[model samples]
Target chain A: AQSVAQPEDQVNVAEGNPLTVKCTYSVSGNPYLFWYVQYPNRGLQFLLKYITGDNLVKGSYGFEAEFNKSQTSFHLKKPSALVSDSALYFCAAEPRTGANNLFFGTGTRLTVIP
Target chain B: SAVISQKPSRDICQRGTSLTIQCQVDSQVTMMFWYRQQPGQSLTLIATANQGSEATYESGFVIDKFPISRPNLTFSTLTVSNMSPEDSSIYLCSGAGGPSYEQYFGPGTRLTVT
Candidate 1:
């Protein structure tokens, strides 16, 4: 089976501080992980993804995530949080199963305060 | 990667009514997917749209309730049938050029069934 888990339902951070949204995955084959953001009334935007490369992958909007094979984790991280970054974040994993479908985690709502 | 767009960015419909959402990809893509995100919840994939075949639905989703169409490589549609308040949420469309586990999303259609 393939699944994604987001540990936190909400993450609160002060603007300018560091932020991290945790994610872990379990799959039969190698994992392909991705992060996406959704604003209040907008569609999800692709933040980044990890296929096969360096442990750390940088993505849009000054965000990056580190893929840990041993831990089975790919967590989203931002060096400095912004109020604008406050939104719903989701982690997804794609296992090369029957249809190569994306399995999404329960979202994390990040609230960045100024 | 491809740019995607959905029609009627947001709409409010009455119970028992149906809403058709259009998904357009800027470039040719081999696969397109429809997803549903309920309020304060993570995304759940509804179906996968292939260019010239029937949509492959995920568990708990059915073609009668959520029919999909993919006339070509760049255009598709997903219709929400007999909607209810529980159906109020964000509907997103995503596309991928190939099966690389890297998907790009559209702006999303916000549907509110009253």
Candidate 2:
């Protein structure tokens, strides 16, 4: 089974400060990890993904994630947070071999305070 | 990147009725998926809608309860049957396309079963 975990339910960060939303995964095979953001009343917007790539992956809206194999983690990061960055973040994972259905973690709500 | 759209951005429905949510993608996609996110919960894969075949449902989700249809590569629908308050959720549709084959999601349909 492929699953991801977001340890934090909510994360608060000051504007212009770096923000990190933690995510970890468990999969039977190589993992395809993804990060998505959802604003209130809207659908999810893809942030970035890590397949077979470099350890650090950059994504939309000035966001990036580090894929740490040893730690089994793919934590989302932003160099500078904005108040508009407040949203729900989800981490998803799937096995590279079969069943591409993504198993998502309980979301982490990020609130960037001004 | 693939652009996806869903109809009935938000709806309030009575219990015991069924609502079919439609998903349309800008480009042809081999795989489309349906997911449900209950209040404050992570997204759960309902089924995989592949063109020209019956949808493959996930565990705890049955075709009878959540019927799916994929008429073509760019279109699919998911019908929630016998609605209840427990079924009140945000339903999302996503498709895999482009060179990376990464998934892109549609604006979710917020279904409120009253």
Off by over 4 Å in 1: none
Interface RMSD of each: 1.8, 2.6
lDDT of candidate 2 over B2-94, digit per residue (tens): 899999898999999999999999989878999998888889999999788899988999999999999999999999999999999999999
Cα error of candidate 1 at position A74, Å: 0.7
Worst 10 residues of 1 chain A by lDDT: A93-102
What value does the TM-score of chain B take for model 2?
A: 0.95
lDDT (tens digit, per residue) of candidate 2 on A1-114: 567899999999999999999999997676788999989878888899998869999999999999999999999999999999999999988777556778899999999999
Give the Å error, residue B96, model 2. 0.7
True-vs-predicted CA distance for residue B102, candidate 2, Å: 2.0
DockQ scores for all predicted structures: 0.63, 0.60
Note the residue pairs that clash in candidate 1.
Answer: none
User: For residues B11-106, what per-residue lDDT tens digits would candidate 1 score against the true structure?
Assistant: 999999999999999999888999988777888899999888999999899999999999999999999999989889889999986655578888
